[model samples]
Target chain A: MHTLIVIDRPPYGSWSGRESLDMAFSLAAFDQPVSLLFVGEGVLWLSQRQDASAIAQKSVERNLKAAAIFGIEALMADQSACQRFGLGDGTLIDGVETVTDLRVTMRRYDHVVFPG
Target chain B: MHTLHIVSKSPGHPRFLECLSMVDTNDVVLLTGNGVVALADSSIEVPSPLYALEGDIQARALTPDSARCQVIGFDDMVALTIQSQRVISW
Candidate 1:
């Protein structure tokens, strides 16, 4: 089944965003086709530089980089969310695609998962 | 019915017990973030086959073996999610 994991929260101060990616990685590991959609404050997760060491937390950027190893190549961010957050493609990490319409994009997947 | 229970907070957090209470014998419990630290403490009783994320373990510097729960990566968590009929996160 093709699953679209949605991340609507930012990377820091909360575990929702990283946990959502963990769910994506898990689904992709079982050879299930999975994609990631970052919206709302979640667009910030794609920031080019996330130094979490001082906070005594694992670098979320490292986890984001590991997506490819799990065979997850379809990473996307909501275009509107990016603009609202003043983040563009250039400010995000490499390989993140921006989608114009999330509603339209969500319909393509068999299931849409939200990190709880 | 097998359920996948996820706890993302430290122990003593209201949601931790709430998540644990929801688990059945066959359910799978996955601990992440701050919750991983609590899982490492031997005193707390875990109900089912428990798992902790490797990244969270490393981040907290907690030994998975000490906690007596299986240390799993994202892939293992994915497999567990697929096997369960329902999932509840806290």
Candidate 2:
């Protein structure tokens, strides 16, 4: 099944963001089609150069990088959400797509999973 | 198109209403996470047929109104997800 994992929470505040990646990787491991979509405050998950060592946590920046290796190439961020956080394409990690109509884009997937 | 609305929030949470408002009679609603509390809290009503994750229900020791909503396992959840034309989670 094709699944779209939506992460709406920022990293470090909770384990939800990283946990969502674990689910995505699991789905990909089972050979299911999977993608990652970041909305609202979740856009922060794509921020470059995140270091979580200060908070005694692993950096989610690593998870974002590993997404492509998991065959989850469809990394997306909501256009409005990125703007809300003042994030531009240049500020985000490479290989992320910014979509304007999130509702329309979401229909492409058979299922959407929210780990938060 | 028929949509599957997945609500992960309990009643009184803002996402619960946002999820309810997005679904209509033709859609399906699955209550997961803290959302299973809605089964006991009768104040919330979903326009579409409602189901709660069996795992969550059992974990919370919640006895859902079986007549109003059904309890489904993870396999059934996967089936429902594929059966729906689209899905959105809140």
Indicate the TM-score of model 2: 0.78
Candidate 1 structure quality by residue, lDDT tens digits, B16-66: 764576566777788988888776677887665788899999987776664
Question: Stretches of candidate 1 above 4 Å error?
Answer: B1-90
Model 2 C-alpha lDDT per residue in residues A32-60, reported as the tens digit of each score: 89999998888998888888888888878
**lDDT, candidate 2, at A11:** 83
TM-score of each: 0.56, 0.78
- Candidate 2 chain A: 10-residue stretch with minimal lDDT: A102-111
Per-model TM-score of chain A alone?
Answer: 0.93, 0.94
* Interface residue Cα RMSD of candidate 2 after superposition: 2.2
- lDDT, model 2, position A104: 73
Error of 2 at B31 (Å): 3.1
Worst 10 residues of 1 chain B by lDDT: B14-23
DockQ of each: 0.03, 0.52
DockQ of prediction 1:
0.03
Comparing to the true complex, what docking class would candidate 1 get? incorrect
Could you tell me which residue pairs clash in candidate 2? none
* Residue B63, candidate 1: alpha-carbon lDDT: 64
